[model samples]
Target: MVAQYPGMWSGRDDGATLWGKLAHDRFRYMAGIYKVHNWIDGGSGSGHNPLFAGRIEYNFLDPEPSPAYYTASTYYGKAHILAIGLAGQYQVNGVGSALQKGDYKAWNVDGLFEKRIGTKARYDVYTLEAAYYQYRTDGVCDIASSFNNHKADYGNIGGINSGTAILVSTAYLIPWRVGWGRIQPLLRYQQFRFAHHLYGPGNPKTRQFDAGANYVMDGHNLRFTFDFARYTPASGTQSDAFLLGMQMQY
Candidate 1:
């Protein structure tokens, strides 16, 4: 077994194993395996429960060896790229419930389309990403716990609840040259929903809108971003927040 971090096996989890990607042009595929300790079903002597996951992605231009965890692009100038991906995961008696046999499953699919238009002095970059996720578990009680416990994409709501979610986001960038380097104006919109309404009457449904600007010095190596976001929840009050951040990469 292999892990991405040192001492990952020190916790309740035994170890993590990853299967590298096999790629051909625009297509890429990979898988992962891991196990968690089960103290109930006879402890370590009963063997650790297993978890499995796999992903497949296709990038239309400048292919990548594997799927990216995020759906954003920082490319400028003349370029066009579009990618689609599908991923799924399964866990056998994981995350606090040992009720019955293996009884949790999750699946998700997404697409990304990004493009840069015009020349150096005047260019526009835009990207759109959309995704959908489906979750199922053994019982209502298990589903309730999984929605709050299971950690995956789209917040803490994945892999074992009887709910559905869809997320869509779009971003646009306009860049201009400055004395120090380049300044980029970014605008983004996001919408997320739980179509099936897991908690019924008063569950949270989220929507967010953000606008930001970035200062790029050495590619993505050195950058500064300032943005404001307005968040609204269907079952709660609305809040507005702002952030100023610097990113440095060697």
Candidate 2:
């Protein structure tokens, strides 16, 4: 959920960035300055001003030692972990059309705790994670108005950008193996409150729930998931779905 948020970093874009990270003891810090929205579409209302982003984390238990600053949802009982993190992003004239631009800003706080219990031969893994986020655009981009005027792409501001969101999840990995793998059962809840309605007068809140089990064959390298989900949109019918998924990594 955090990665999918409006201002969060997910992957590369049509721009350049100067970024670095630092890790010392139980603390980790990273920051970057970006020259973004350089595409010809001119959909970011961006100018010479750069975007700034940074994150800081503190580990209360075992420190994460990944040199790439990456984190996993579950360590599969390899180690005990407890950590908290805060992140923020900001850019001038980052949202809305060039003629009606707005400054973009976002921030989030998150925490994770994972531990293994019982004897080594029959231990179970427990994980808990949560996060809160706020994203804003100074109220300059009206999505409905932009869509009606065919200016939705004027600044990549057509989606649900200005909102407050939250997520909470818990999981338990049973020690007993099922065939060649172990089972991890998890439950998650998420909610988003939009800053403004997209169409008519109504509550601008969306929610989702997920209950699932993962079959772990080789940690994150190979796994299969069976999930059931329920979703409630801001102004639509509630829906439910079942999913089966497989994941593999080198």
Top model number, TM-score: 2
Q: Which 10-residue window in model 2 sums to the lowest lDDT? A: 4-13
**What TM-score does model 1 achieve against the real structure?**
0.67
**Per-prediction TM-score to the true structure, in the order listed:** 0.67, 0.83
Minimal lDDT window, size 10, model 1: 1-10
- Those runs of model 2 whose alpha carbons end farther than 4 Å from true positions after fitting are 1-24, 35-42, 46-48, 142-160, 197-203
Across 111-162, the per-residue lDDT of candidate 1 in tens digits comes to 8777777776777777676777765544432322123343332221222334
lDDT of each: 0.55, 0.72
lDDT of 2 by residue, 180-228 (tens): 9999999999998777653235538789999999999999899999999
Q: Best lDDT goes to which candidate?
A: 2
Taking every candidate in turn, the Cα RMSD to the unseen true structure, in Å, is 6.9, 3.9
